[model samples]
Target: MKNIFTIVLLFATLSFYGQDKKISFLDLVGNNIQVPRGCEAQSVYELQACNGTSIKWDYYSTDMLNEVFNATISAFAEGNSSKTEVTFTSFGGQLKGYKFKMGTTFQYFLMGTIKDQPLMINLGTPKDITKSDDLDGFLSLFFDEVG
Candidate 1:
């Protein structure tokens, strides 16, 4: 009886631990850009376009928690359309930019603006997203800008 009780307790602990663990990217995009439960999406204002010899990028974390996570990118407006490049410092190193695109949809195209430049847009796709995940999945989607 004691052995059975011990085994049950062990299983319960493991189960709880597993539940605490966050979900992966694959889970989020498995069924499409369905905003996961307990998660919400927000939009930013128009993105500024610039085409010059150099541009800057900025990074910031909007949310951080098991419940929700969000981030935004912003840039200075140069004109109607600008050719710019952006480099991401977080999550290893990635450089992205936009060329000859209208600034109206730049908000949706890029993850947001950084240092007044647009980051590489995700186009809403995860490499190994999965369903049934929680905030982590949503966060990953946000990072990837999988709108």
Candidate 2:
């Protein structure tokens, strides 16, 4: 019985460790965002948060981060007017994201260092995709901020 329990616990720990640091679609903006129509996940490039316990924000910079978001927005807007803003949280630190229109459809690019790694969210949009709840949820994952 002890052996069986130990094996089970070990497997559980290994499984959790294997999935240790990954940014899934949910980690992007939590709920209220989904895989939009007319497009599939073209590709995903993930920068792992850490091997052991570590902070996610130390890997990237504000200027480089904003460039990614702004460049995506500009591409979607096709050289039209586009804008982005930087936001910071005491716990989560700095991040950048934006919403824009491409031809007739909407797109979003939300990127930041949350969970102690760089996360870039790029996808088609849902109506009211610009939700404060999404941003708060994204940032709050790092900080112990309430409400």
Candidate 3:
């Protein structure tokens, strides 16, 4: 009985260590974000947030915040009746932005400034996330903040 218990414990320890660990990755543009175990960033602008999700980031002058925001709203609203604002508090901070369903997938846009530069991070996922709670979880999984 003691030998069997020891073997089970050892197996459990090894299994835990063998699994891929989810990591918090800081983007090349100085944004602190999160990615799943298998995803790796290819550049500052485009990255895979996970195996099936895509993330795109861009930077602009702080002065362009309103311009960019309005442009984004108009762009998403064009031909898409589901475009709406989504605001939630995640692990990083309070994120207020827009969300729209493009085709069968959903995309979330978060706009903020870090160190005086306008930062826009877009997260695209296949999940149908329509509630504030779901939006919070989705943002928490991909974005922290631009630090």
Candidate 2 clashing pairs, residues 3+ apart or interchain: 56-116, 56-117
Q: Could you arrange the candidates by TM-score from highest to lowest?
A: 3, 2, 1
Q: What's the count of clashing pairs in each model shown?
A: 15, 2, 0
What's the lDDT of the predicted structure labeled candidate 3?
Answer: 0.66
> Which of candidates 2 and 3 is the stronger one according to TM-score?
3
Off by over 4 Å in 1: 18-96, 99-119, 124-147
TM-score of each: 0.23, 0.37, 0.60
Compared with the true structure, what per-residue lDDT tens digits does model 1 show for residues 42-99?
3221111212111122233432211121222224335534444432222333333333
Candidate 3 residue-wise lDDT, 50-83, digit = tens:
6467777677776686688779878878888887
Instruction: Report residue 109 deviation for candidate 1 (angstroms).
Output: 6.7
What is each predicted model's overall lDDT from 0 to 1? 0.33, 0.44, 0.66
For lDDT, candidate 1 versus 2, the one ahead is: 2
